[model samples]
Target chain A: MDLTADMTNQPFPTQLFGDDAIDTAEEKAKPSSRQTVGDPFVENPRMICRDVYVYYAEKCAINNVSIDVGRNEVLAMIGPSGCGKSTFLRCLNRMNDTVGTCRVEGDIRLDDMNIYDPSVDVVPLRASVGMVFQKPNPFPKSIFDNVAYGPKIHGLVSNKTELAEIVETSLTKAGLWNEVKDRLHEPGTGLSGGQQQRLCIARAIAVSPEVILMDEPCSALDPIATAKVEELIAELREQFSIVIVTHAMQQAARVSQRTAYFHLGDLIEVGPTDRIFTNPRHQLTEDYITGRFG
Target chain B: MQNTPQQSPITLRINAGLKKRYNTEKRFKRMGISAIVIAMTFLVFLFGSIISNGYTAFQQTYIQLDVSFDQTFFTGENLAAANFPGLVKKTLYSMFPDVTSRNDKKLLTQLVSSNAAFRLMGMVTKDPKLIGTTQKIWVLADDDVDMLIKGHYDRNVAESNRRINDKQLAWIDALAANGKITKKFNTQFFTSGDSREPEQAGIWGATRGSIYTLFIALALSFPIGVAAAIYLEEFAPNNGWTDLIEININNLAAVPSIIFGLLGLAIFINFWGMPRSTPLVGGLVLTLVTLPTIIIAGRAALKSVPPSIREAALGIGASKIQMVTHHVLPLAMPGMLTGTIIGMARALGETAPLLMIGMIAFIVDIPGSVTDPATVLPVQIFLWADSPERAFTEKTSAAIIMLLAFLMLMNGLAVYFRNKFERKW
Candidate 1:
């Protein structure tokens, strides 16, 4: 109940949008309306979402939020529960398309191509932009197969030996190869939670995506495993531009170059990680950091 | 405070209410265990009764003899009229050399099976050299002799009230003295076709019918059911139409199987003019009954797969189709098959639906193809059950055993697949 309380203040989506003015009602919840806000853009961005609006059936879940993911940088999106941080992350890879009623509006681009364009095939777009989830979901297969699934599907390797090499390299990048090399044929689900999370990361990386999205990847792990995954994420950012959604502000400060704060589905502040943590910003962002309220 | 809390001002103590709660919890646990035990007892009782009645059927009584097989036996052009019974009667008469009345001869021939002639003919056909041989052979004994040997016949009772009279019992005793009467495996019950004579009836025809019908049901239901489930669960928009479809599928699963029989009668036979009582037609009816079960079970199976797996697949740039086919379908296959097995088992045991589809008839020949007229094992059991002959009861029980075996075999396959493809997420 505690974990779910913040995501949805009201019990139902239908209750949130009782009438046709849901868009206007969602607009009023944004703190930007009351004060001027600083810019969150950069000169060279890898992926950009402009005036994005997401709705679940008739209810607006994320209203008029825009942010840019920088090239080869760790951009951490931190927010309380149900603030649409995870939802916004899924949109980058078009993972929301799996939901029957979830609809996304506005322009979202990866590099020069508009990913939301009708002509775009989500398969290649997803291949170019990878994602790792909070809970580890290893296919019901051997560890080696789990990691090789992406590369095999994309035909990244010309032969089995090359595929094995790609799997080894991906696992090494995810920092899981050493512990799991001898047991690559064992089920991936048999690994420790941290190791399985690393396996998912390895699976994601095997396809050689330019960007990777992680949704609270350590929330289901113990502290020790979380620390290992944190280390892995720090190392992974060097090769792939990473976007992480986390509730742990310290994790945001520790692993990110820049941090963005989301509240009530609004992007309240974005700045250098040190400045966002130390310097004062908007009242909502200040209160959130000081443990006053989510 | 922690150490002295028991003696604090609140004066906490173990009360009657707390003790009662603990007692109730224990009682609940005990009752739950008792419920499971009761259910297990019923299952054990059911299987016990069926096996006790059916096991005797697998091994039939036989009488060993040294009947001379000469060229005169097959004098007729057609072997169906071969005088193997006359020869056996003569051999029995020579063995006793004491009974000579027409009544005694008639009762003495009852010691061996009526199909004893066919048994000899089968041997001669298998080896032509036997036509001139005086080889010892074990021939099938009559069902009454079979019961007498199996200890089911009480010779102490009045001979007039019982199936075998005292004269036939005397012949059986004479044969028993020479170690001629024995219990051999009843291979004919499995190899031969249906017969008016209970002893000659075998389950092969009905077994073939069940196999064809079940395969047809599975082939028709599995793909369509799984596809419909995937569409409803993963693709269909949430609206009145899909909701109605979901409700219809759920209701269909609960609809009486007999209703499907009527539907099959009207659609497949009456309207389409398909042959009645054939496995192909029976299979179609069973498909109609099994589709809803598979669809419901397939949806549950697909639903049991966590959303995280779907997210992981989709997150890695796999298309929606890839996400479902590569991940969701494989994960759900075990459950789908388990459901399909249950549905097929239900179909295998179904008789009411087959009755309307003409599978309740007395089919004599073993069905060679799906279109040939045939009855499933349960229907064969039903027809045998309806016969007035006392000997048909054992054959009915044996057929019931055969039906049960088919059910267990299908379920065993389901369990194997469940364990084989079982995920550890």
Candidate 2:
């Protein structure tokens, strides 16, 4: 492949070039064969990305990625470790600001506003776009405090009674209120593993976020806890747009409405979850789904 | 089986060397247990010796005398005009009545401390009515007399080598036989304040000062240290400023505590001109020395909070400050408190730093304010230990016991806090 041409030519139509196009171009310069696949679930996109590139010092971690996440949909990004799926997820909430060497270029917008705009307040931005982590981590406080924390910070409750009510409703929505209602004063960390993850979900819901970003929220959980979280994610999509990064292909197929495949820091293909699993258009996507290579 | 046995006799055993190595391993295990036992025995022996030698220092003896106030000597004319020391000597000689006799004079002088005169004068000035009335009094005897009563005096030793002579022993024996001088448990040693007289001083002043200083230290250190730690650990951007601050805090932790005392002396004492020898300055010095400890521990505690908890808070739209205050700080409090108590304990035992700021003196009154001159337990012990009087040896040991008790209490508090609030997850 002629790497020099891609690096030097600013106007080169990268879409027209296949993996072997550069090698063939030196001989004939013929237009490379190309096919376009539409993402069916992008009818009402909430976040649209175009040519997103994330760099860490000298190395590029996310290179030339473009995708869209739809409203009230569960969008799952699946890739192997260091494939940049989690990096892309963090970019959604601007959580990557915490990383010292990381830098991002290109356009990422929520609705019509650029999220990376300097005028944006990160506090409200994070509130609008919430995130869950791989492990179940509850505050080392009462179970009620865990759920009430978000509402209190956002000033959603005017009094203790209102806070208590918010805590109850949030826990009920997360489907954990019944089991822990009698023990609201007990430390949240005292709960079982699955219960703790659900408590975390309750905590997230208490803030009334519009979007929730989850970075492998079930990776550390047992099969049963993973199933519970998956079910909750499906239920959660009725109210909020959810972006999830997962290594489990089966989980993506089970819970997501749309699936985006990431490989070698590039967005290979994105489409309806069923279509991506059944008949992927991209050769890389097909190979990955068929277990030929990741 | 017989054929197999015969074949085994001819065959080489490949694992025979391994069996020999296993036997050596068994021998090593036996030696390991013996080493552990020997180490434990030595530790026990050391502990036993410390308790045995230090136990007697907790008790003291006093002489109860029905001292008659000589109306002629302490009249209004004498009180307004008499030399304080001369009046004290005249009153003391009246109690013995043999101070002028050459042989008995030495005995009489050795029975009471020279500083006793000053202490008596102070008492007379406080209540002039006692000048004309005979009142029962409990006075602390001289160090040699105290040593005799406590069995520290070696009567068989040469007169020149001993602090007390045979004549002094005779007077002590007479007083003991007459029931005028008796050994009683020294409750005042724990309740009263420090004095120049070794027999009269107590840990009360220094102990109270330590409490007040630690109170201030914990009050300031816990909140400021935890807040700074939380900001740096959870919210601060990974920039040069934060990095430099982290390094400075670590260096502060390693800096000699005495340097902090010098800083306090310069800034709080000379510059600010706060009261010298006050618990306020001592507390301020201790706070500087303790801040690094609290901050380091607080940072560790904040770091111990799993990143997942922060993410959970962030996910809910909590602000950076909110996330730290609501989640991170609460989880880290147990460890933070443990650090605070440990820092206070270290402050309690610190003598050199407090000494630099003028905490090494007699403060005979309980401090009513932080600005009042005070001496802490360690400094009190140091002062007592440096006294020339032989009785101060026991007083120093008593002061050490008080200091150690305070330290143990602080350590116990640390352990209790850790266990009470430690998160299982």
Candidate 3:
């Protein structure tokens, strides 16, 4: 009932305060700014975003935001629906270029090179930065064909024997080779939900991409499948950088080396997974982690 | 407490308004069922009429005539020097047994086909060594005799109205009783070619033409349509080149089939100067008409493939073109093939377009090549349907049956392909 009254006659903090009160407030903000400088987690950034914004037509979906993904790290992005975590993940590979009206502004770099550079070809970019969707989207073909698809396209193998070897190695890395090798000719869709996800991973790995992005890859899978995928992600970090967007906070804490908390298109806090969960600096991040609000 | 135990709590479980809504929902479902039943009934009626009227066309009737080779007229020395019409006239006289007057001979000659003599001459010339040998030969009788054998003619009809007199009937009866002339199954209907005489005509030539034309259509349309579809759906960027092609393909599919006929006539016949009425021209015209259908269906099949599959391939570093050729095309093939076959079936039934392109009346010996003149089944049926001969009515019906059978077979093939290779994913 008091909501309308607060909206129309809202008073500014500095307007209501004297000079001494403003001085005290400025001193408090200074200590926090100094505290941010000494944070060890921000030191070695893998992917650094500075003032990134994305817009569709007139609507700003992702407002100015900045964060860093550390080297050899699993950084999980979590937010409520429409919070732009997925949008930010797509920026890593310039996948948003596929959309007609989507406009991305500001700098996003992979190591040192700007990924959004007009000179960059999306084909190779997508190859280096692979993405896994929420659903287990396996090709409607044999498991062998599915795994061989990427390697064959890039001419990674010289002949049939070499392609077969690549498929075997990729499937083995995804922990799916032994289960599916005997029935490689069977259609990929015949596999269970978890197996299909792992097959997708094998397909992704076959091309030997540098980074893997999972966008709620286990959302369509059962709990068992989700757990298997989570294990795969943790193991995957040793070979490639992994960025994941998830709705499950517990999953993020369990799998990620670092966590970035986002709310309303803003990157509120990012730190080691344990610190983000146990000792968040931002009130919004704390509220989300503690289940007080999303 | 005892009094309270006696009266259980009065529960209201069902709402009156909700109950009414449930009843209305039931009524709506019943109405939907009835509507579906009505639609099915209409479809059944159409199918029933087509099958019933068309089924009889598959079987045909023919009057088998056993003519004795006259040694005098077909003498070995004279056969080479004799005109075929003279031998045909002598054979027609043989059919009468005894013609007392010249007027009766003339009337009897009219009853026989003008080309009947040519056919007899052909038989004699095939075996000049047999010119001296007298043997029984089976020849197709004239249309009137064939109608009489098939029970379409009445002997009791008035002489003025009847095409054949009672005397001719007596002669036919005498010949039938003596086993010289009899009605038998017309196997020639499947083996012989077109003739001016309705009784002698068969589906063989047109059937062969259709087969050859369809072969050409399948060879050209399937590969081209599918390739274009794959390029448009997978590799080509969504720019003006692809947009223009897509628009043209869609427009081409809807263009009047007659326009394709005109195109075939002008381009293939006039400019390229291909043989008129050739299966090549017909096939080329049909391919143009069929390409759009196949491409549209192929695109739909390609689009049905989920984007996640493409991402999986891309994630693996598969090039865009490789992803399409290896993964997308195989999945889309069944639907594409089905579309091609359905388009071909539609092409098989097209008469008006073929007519405009000169496939209507060409009397070809055989469809030797794309450059050779040819006639297809529907065109043959159309020719038969337009003839003034009363017997050709049955021949047209018979040809219709053959055309329908071909269409059914194509449709069946489409169903088979769809079932056998359609991927669930």
User: Which residues of candidate 2, in runs, are more than 4 Å off?
Assistant: A1-36, A160-165, B1-50, B66-106, B109-138, B215-220, B239-245, B361-366
Cα distance off (Å), candidate 3, residue B369: 2.3
RMSD list, candidates in order:
7.9, 6.9, 8.4
Models ranked on lDDT? 1, 2, 3
Off by over 4 Å in 3: A1-51, A159-161, B1-85, B88-96, B109-128, B216-220, B227-255, B263-275, B362-364
Name model 1 segments beyond 4 Å from true. A1-36, A222-235, B1-14, B64-66, B70-82, B93-104, B125-128, B131-135, B154-160, B178-180
Q: Give the range of the ten consecutive residues with the poorest summed lDDT in model 2 chain A.
A: A28-37
Q: Put the candidates in TM-score order, highest first.
A: 1, 3, 2
Q: Is candidate 1 or candidate 3 better by lDDT?
A: 1
Q: lDDT by residue for model 1 over B13-98, one digit each (tens)?
A: 44425777899999999999999999999999988887887888888888987888767877887765777778788777888888
Among these predictions, the greatest lDDT belongs to 1
lDDT per residue (tens digit) for residues A1-294 in model 1: 242432232222322222223223233224445231344665467877777889999988888876678778899998788988999999998888878789999888887688989999988888989998988888878999999999888878999999999999999999998999999999888998999999999999999999999999999999999999999889988888999999999999989988888877777777678877886356667778889886
TM-scores of the candidates in the order shown: 0.87, 0.82, 0.84
lDDT accuracy of residue A83 in candidate 3: 85
Indicate whether candidate 1 or candidate 2 has the larger TM-score. 1
lDDT of candidate 2 vs native?
0.77
- Tell me how large the interface RMSD of candidate 1 is: 1.3
**Per-residue lDDT over A96-194 for candidate 3, one digit per residue giving the tens place of the 0 to 100 score:** 765668899988766666788888777777778888878888888789988887776777789999999999999999999889989999989999999
Q: What is the C-alpha local distance difference test score of each model?
A: 0.84, 0.77, 0.75
lDDT at position B178, candidate 3? 71
